[model samples]
Target: MKAMRVKNGLKISVIIMFIFMYGCKQSSYKEFVMADAVEVSESYEIVEEKEMTYKLNSNQTNVPLNLKIIKTASSRYKVKNIVTATRRIKIIAQKHGAYISDLRFQNDLYKKENRFTIKVPQKYFDTVMDSVNTVVDFVEYENITTKDVTEEYIDIETRLKTKLEVKARYETILRKNAKTVEDILLTEDKLRIIQEEIESAQGRLKYLTNKVAFSTIQIDLYEPVEYKAEPETYTKTFWDETKQGFANGWWYIKSFVVVLINLWPLLIIGLVTFFFVRKRLKK
Candidate 1:
């Protein structure tokens, strides 16, 4: 009976040890899961912060955006006098704070024409057009054109912002993460390329803005003159004709003398052969 009691006691002890080991394992598993949860939460917070930063930067950079429109016009008309009309147009353009970018004047037998390329403020485009119309006698044609560049403008702006952000990130990496000389040089080259692209985008934006702010007007002013017929044939006086005839005769005589001089050796050979043949025939 004592041996039986000892064996039962040993089985109970073994069961208790197994229970203690399983509890320890369960506690360690719980601790590991909690650590993973904390890391995941921290990563989510970081992602949310980055998203907020992007939104804030985007809003700050793009404010007061407006539609970009480029206006241009062309007008062709007849005027009483091209010079007078041109002067009047120049004065009108100056009064409206406009300038002539190009001017060309042509005078032919049938007409006189003056072409002008005028740059005017967008607000004064219609006013300038009306002012120019006062000098027109007859309208040949008038054309107005408009181009919308809002999409392109916004697209460039967005791309530029993205490039700037990328450049900033690369700069941070270069400052903090780049360890080798090769890595530093590669980052610098990438930065140079990005800077060139940024400058090009900036230039294009400036051009578009300028075009939107100002308008172009091309004007062609012309004056028609009476057609004067030119003589088909010129009639020379009798003394003029006599002089021309004498000059032609002198030229022919000089040409004949030159030809004879060039053939002098051949002429001597022919004469010698004729003399020899004649002497033989006479014998």
Candidate 2:
């Protein structure tokens, strides 16, 4: 009985050991499978995110640009010299892929000025400005303005696309689904409005595009007034004194005439009184 009992205990121990080992293996396999599933899910998410990011990046059609306008004032010593500089400026502008949009000049005793408005291709804007700087003797003022229209441009582009899509939808409806005259007329009206909006947006886009592609520069050149004095010779001084005396004499004669006119009434009264007094004395 003692031996049987010992054998039974050994059998029980072996069975328990086998069951524990099998359970541990099963748990490890399940954990591995779960980990693998988690890894696959994470990888899929990463790929999906990458794809989304790429799509978003690809949607941008053009780079946003800032429109710039530059203004500068330069001076040359001589008024005539400014003309040469102006001609040279025009030549330089043309060589740098620029054009003179406006030119104005003023020639006067006080000041001489030459103003130019130039439009330069954006790619050559800096080159043109540098060339212009070389053409002047002195620089007075420089102003540069930049406008960020990226948001505005993008908004307009989006609106334009939406409008075009709406227009196409209307056209499709008009061609395929409009069964009655009323339907046709209504669709046509919608199409017209959409078309007008599209045109307006197009015009605005074109203006923005031009502003981005070209930069404006205003250049002002001037020569300040110079007063000259010449030394007077003795003969010239004598003539000047003579002319001054003649002017003073003329002024005195005019003063005498004015005084006589003012005293006429008093003189007339005095003369009458004298006549009356003489008559009384004679009587």
Candidate 3:
């Protein structure tokens, strides 16, 4: 009897372990499927029908990104053009937005800053972004993307039409007090899908419209200081100036001595030039 009891206990423990393992595995698979799936379906029959009609197709499509890469500022003229283009774009997209940059002071010295944005044709994202690097002062970063949403656009159109027709039918049934429980559930689901698709399409159309209408080019400009030579100016009475010069010369001599005392390196070079340069070069 003791042996039998022990055996039964072991069997129960095994069964419990198996159940826990299976539950964990099932949960993991569910998560994996959810993460990997597309939110919308591929069956775009209604969307296609609407496309033949007078409906917009943005809901089915998404942003196709064309990121720019800039290297050396090869042409100042191009930079100027880009600046002008950006200004025009800002004015046009004023209702949408004028994307402004944060004040990024590079260092203690105040530097000249330039910014620009360009909107290339969506189809030309790769080519335009690649060209950006050639005209920029420096390439800070780059991004590029291309997405085809023909299927999504089609799917949404089909769904929206079907839902609308179904909703109309449901209203008829509701007026007659004939909508069954299943009818209500079905109508609710269809309405939900229609609402979702409409929102999705509107968002996509807004994005595409923005892209087509405006192109932005972020630009920065740097100008190096160049040297110029000028004739000397001497404005002094000879005797007075000479005396003043002597004083200034004496002051400089003192300063130089202090500098030499601090910089052994300059002292060594000076001595070498003054003493050894002639002798060494003579050979």
Best by TM-score: 1
Q: By lDDT, highest first, what's the ranking?
A: 1, 2, 3
Candidate 2: give the clashing pairs. none
Q: Model 2, range 16-102, lDDT digits (tens) per residue?
A: 999999999999999999999999999999999999999888887465345333233232323337778888988988887788888
- Candidate 1 lDDT over residue span 1-283, tens digit each: 9999999999999999999999999999999999999999999999999999999998898865577889999999999988889999999889988899999889888999899899999889999998888877988999999998999999999999999999999899999999999999999999999999999999999999999898999999999999888899989999999999999999999999999999999999999999999999999
Model 3: CA > 4 A from native: 1-111, 116-145, 177-283
C-alpha lDDT values of all predictions: 0.94, 0.82, 0.55
C-alpha lDDT of candidate 2 relative to the true structure: 0.82
| TM-scores for candidates 1 onward, in order | 0.58, 0.54, 0.30
Write model 3 residue lDDT over 162-269, tens digit each, in one string: 766766776666556556887777667766775676677667655655654444444444333334455598567889988999999999999998987899988788
